[model samples]
Target chain A: MTAYALLVEYDGAGLVGWQRQSNGLSVQEAIETAATSLNGGATPLATAAGRTDAGVHAEGQVVHLDLAADLPPARLRAALDFHLRPQRIAIRAACLAPEGWSPRFSAARRHYRFRILNRPAKPALEEGRVWHVPLPLDAAAMHDAAQALLGKHDFSAFRAASCQAEHAIRTLDRLDVTRVGEEVVIHASARSFLHHQIRNLAGTLHMVGLGRRPVSWPRELLEGRDRRRAGQTAPPEGLVFLGVDYDPPLPWVTSDRA
Target chain B: MTAYALLVEYDGAGLVGWQRQSNGLSVQEAIETAATSLNGGATPLATAAGRTDAGVHAEGQVVHLDLAADLPPARLRAALDFHLRPQRIAIRAACLAPEGWSPRFSAARRHYRFRILNRPAKPALEEGRVWHVPLPLDAAAMHDAAQALLGKHDFSAFRAASCQAEHAIRTLDRLDVTRVGEEVVIHASARSFLHHQIRNLAGTLHMVGLGRRPVSWPRELLEGRDRRRAGQTAPPEGLVFLGVDYDPPLPWVTSDRA
Candidate 1:
C-alpha cells in the first residue's frame, strides 16, 4: 500500500464543501470517486488539511490518500485529474507521502485569502469570486486594527454557531488587509481556525474599515468571549484556502525535479 | 442633443460581440436598450471604439451616444448603469463628448491583451478567461520574436478571412509578450487592427515560443502578404479590449472633481 499526498486547487462554487454530505456534491466525494475509479472501483479515503465551506475557493489545498497499488507520481496525478474531469477540482501535484504524514494532523499552518470588490459597479469577471461592497473601505485602518487579534487567544466571539471544535483557543499568526487596485484583499494565516473565525473577523474588520465600529471593538469582543458581541460573519463566497504548510516538507515538492 | 462619451467594461462570455445581432444578445444591444428605456422608450445609437468578437472581454471599452436630453454626467452614468443591471456590463464613467468626438474615428490608439495559461492541469479560476496550453512555453523567445512584426507594414498574413478592411497596410505600434507566473500575457497596441490580427499574431508567437517555428518566421509571413502563411487565429476567449485613447481626453477624466 502507498500513502500519496496530493496538492489540489478548486473552485468551490456549487460544491457542498470539502466533506461528503447528503445535501449536494462535494469536493471530497469528487476526489474519492476519481480515486476509486483509478483504483478499479475500490473506494479510497481522501482526507484534506481543511474541510472548506461551500462557495469557498482553494488555490493550494493539501490532501492525503492511500492506494492499494503503487503508481508513478505523475501517472497518479494524471489519472486522478482525468477522472476529475468537467469538475472545478484539480490535482496540481502528487507524490508518495513522507512516513505516516497526514494532511489534517501534520499540517503546521493554513493560509486563507478573502477578496472584497470595493466598488460601486457590480463585479462581472469576478462575479461569484468576490464579496462586492459598494462602499469604499479604508484598508490602512483595517490593517492597523487587525493587529490587535494577533497571537494566541480564545476566539469564541468569532466562532460559528455550529463549530464542533472542543476548544476555541488558536494562535493567529497574521492578518493583513491591503488594497490591490480596486479590490481589498485580506490574508490570514494560523495554526487552525474556528468554523467561521476568518469570515467573522473579516466582517468585523469591514465595519472598522467603514468607520462604523471603533478599532478597539474587536479586542473588546474578544475579551467578552461572546459571539453576539462581534460583527456578522462575512459571506463564504469571498473566502479562499490559499495553501497549507507541513513540517519536513512533502515529496510532492522534490518529485518535480525527479 | 448631447454626444456623450462613456467609459465601459464588460465580460463577453455569453455576449454576441459588441455589435447588435439578430441571433443573440450583444453588448451594444444591451446598452442601446438601456439607453432607450432611460430616454422614454426612444432608441439611441451606441457606437463603440471597436466591435469586439464574441467571448472577448473588455476592461476599458469606449463608446459614444447622442442623448436627446442633456443631463448631469453623474446622473447619466447612474441612470444608464441602473438600467444596464442584470447584464455583465458596467458604465465606468460618462461625460459630454469633446465637440464632435466619435468613438471609432476620434480614437488615437487601441490596446488589447491576450492571456495564455501554460500548465499541465486545467485552470479552474481562469477557465474561460484564458487560453489553456498544456505544454511548456518559452516566453522570452516569444517576446524576442514578436518584435519582428513591430512598426508599419502590410499584414495580410495575419488578417481574418472575412476582414472588411479596404487596405492591408497598418502601422503596428507594439506587440509584447511577458510571462506572469504560469500565465503568458500578450499586449498589443495600434491605431487600429485588422480583424483577428492580434489573435493570429498570438497563435504565431505561440509557435515561436514552443520552438516549433523560428523567431524570424513572422517577418517572413509578413513579407509574404498571404493569410495562409501565418498561424491560425487564437480563440476569442483569450482576447480582451484593454482600452482606447483619444487626442483630447474624454470628459470623464476632467469631470471627476465636479
Candidate 2:
C-alpha cells in the first residue's frame, strides 16, 4: 500500500460533508467511487485532515489515502482527478507519501475563515455561500474585544453539545475580525478544534458585532465550557478550511486517493 | 421635469441587451416600467452611459433620466433603487443632474474588462459570470502584442460585421492583460468602442495566448481594418463596462425636458 497526500479545494454546498454516509452523498463517497473506476476495481479508503461540516467549504483541504498499487505518482493523481472531473471539488496538488502518514494526525495547524456579509439586501448571487448579516456591526469594537480570547483556555462554554473531544482545552493562536466594504472577514488559526468550536465562537463574536454583548463575551465563553452559556452556533455556510501545513521535500504526501 | 443622473450596476445574463425590444426583456424596459409605476402619472424614460449588448455586464454604468417630481438626489437614488430592487440591475448612486448632462454625449471615455478563467473546470458557481478557457495562456505575450495596438488606429479588423460606426479610427488609451492564478483579467480603456471591438480583440489576443498566432496580431488587426480579416467575437459573458468618466462634480444635470 502506498501512503500519499493530496491538496483539495471544494464548494461544500452539494456535499454531505467529507465523510462516507449511507443515506447522503459525501466527498469521500464520490472520491472512492471515482477511484474504484479509475483503478480498475481497486477500492481505496480516503481520509482527510479535517472532516468539515456539511455546509462548510474548503480552499485547501488536505487528505491522504492508501492505494493498492505502486502506480506512478502522477498517474494516480491524474487518473483520479480525470475521473472526478465533473465534481465541484478539485485535487489541486498531489504527491507520494511516507509510510504511516495520516492526514489528520500529521497536520499541525489548521486555518479557517468565517465570512459575515452585513447588508440589508439578501445577497442574491452570493446567498447560501455567506452569512447575510442584516445588523450594523462595529468592527473596531468587535476586534478589540476578540483579543482577550486569544491564547490558551478551557473553552467549555463555547464547546458544542455534540463535540467528541475529551478535553475542551485548546490554544487559539489568533483571532482577527475586520471589515472590507460590506463584508466582515474573520480569520482564526488553531492547532485543531473540538466539534463545532469555530462555529460556536463565530456565533458569540457576532453578538459583539451587534454590540449586544461586551467584547469580553469570547473570553467569558472560554472560561465557561457550559454549552448553554455560549452564543448560538454560527451557520456552516460561511466557514472555509483555508489549508494545512506539512513537512515537505518528499512531495506533499497528501495523495489524491480518488 | 427633474433631471437625474443614475449610477447603475447589473448582471446582464438574462436580458437581450440594455435597450427596449418586442422580442424579449431589456434592462431599460424593466427600469422604465418600474419607475412609471412609482410616478403614478407620467411615464419615465431611462438612458444609460453605454447601451450594452446582451450578456454584457456593468459595474458602474451611468445614465441620465427624467423624473416627474423634484426628488432630492439621495432620496431619488434610494427610491429608484428600492423600486428597481427586484431586477438584476442596481442603482448605486443617483442625483439631479446639471442641465444637458447626456450619458452618451457628455461621457469622455469608457472602460471595459474581460475575464478569462484558464482552468479545466466549467466553473459551476460562476456559471454566467466568467468565460472558461481551459488551455494555459501566455499573459505576457498577449499584453506585449496588445501594446502595439494602443493609441489612435483604424481598427477595422476588430469591428463587428454589423457595427454602425462611420469610421474605424479610435484611440485606445490603455490595454493591460494579467494572469492571476487560474484567471486572466484584461483591462482596456478608450473614448468609445466599435461594436464587438473588445470581443474581437480578445479573440485575436487569445490566439497569441495559445501561441497559435504571431505576437503582432494586434498591430496587424489595427492596420487591416477589414471586418472579415479579424478574429472571431468572443462570448459576451466575460465583458463588463467598468465605468464612464466625466468632468466635474459628477454630472448634476438641471433639465430633463430640454
lDDT of each: 0.88, 0.79
lDDT string for model 2 (A200-241, tens) is 888888898898999887777677667898788999998999
Highest lDDT: give the candidate number.
1
Please give the clash total of every predicted structure, in order: 0, 20
Q: What TM-score, to 2 decimals, does candidate 2 have?
A: 0.84
Q: For candidate 1, give the lDDT of residue A57.
A: 92
What's the true lDDT of residue B40 in model 2?
A: 63
lDDT of 2 by residue, B1-258 (tens): 788887777788888988998988888887787678556666788888888999988877887788778777766665666787677776666767777788887888999999998764445345566787767789999999999989998888898878888998899998999998778889999988888999999988988998888898768767867777767788999999988888765843212222
Using TM-score as the measure, which candidate wins? 1
Q: Residue A84 of model 1: what lDDT? A: 89
How accurately is candidate 1 docked according to DockQ?
0.46
Fraction of native contacts, model 1: 0.35
lDDT of 1 by residue, B1-258 (tens): 778888888999999999999989999999999998666679999999999999999988999888888788767887787788899898777878887778998889999999998877778777789998877889999998989889999999999989999988998898999999879999999999999999999999999988999988989999999898888788999999999988877758312332
Give the chain B TM-score for each candidate: 0.97, 0.94
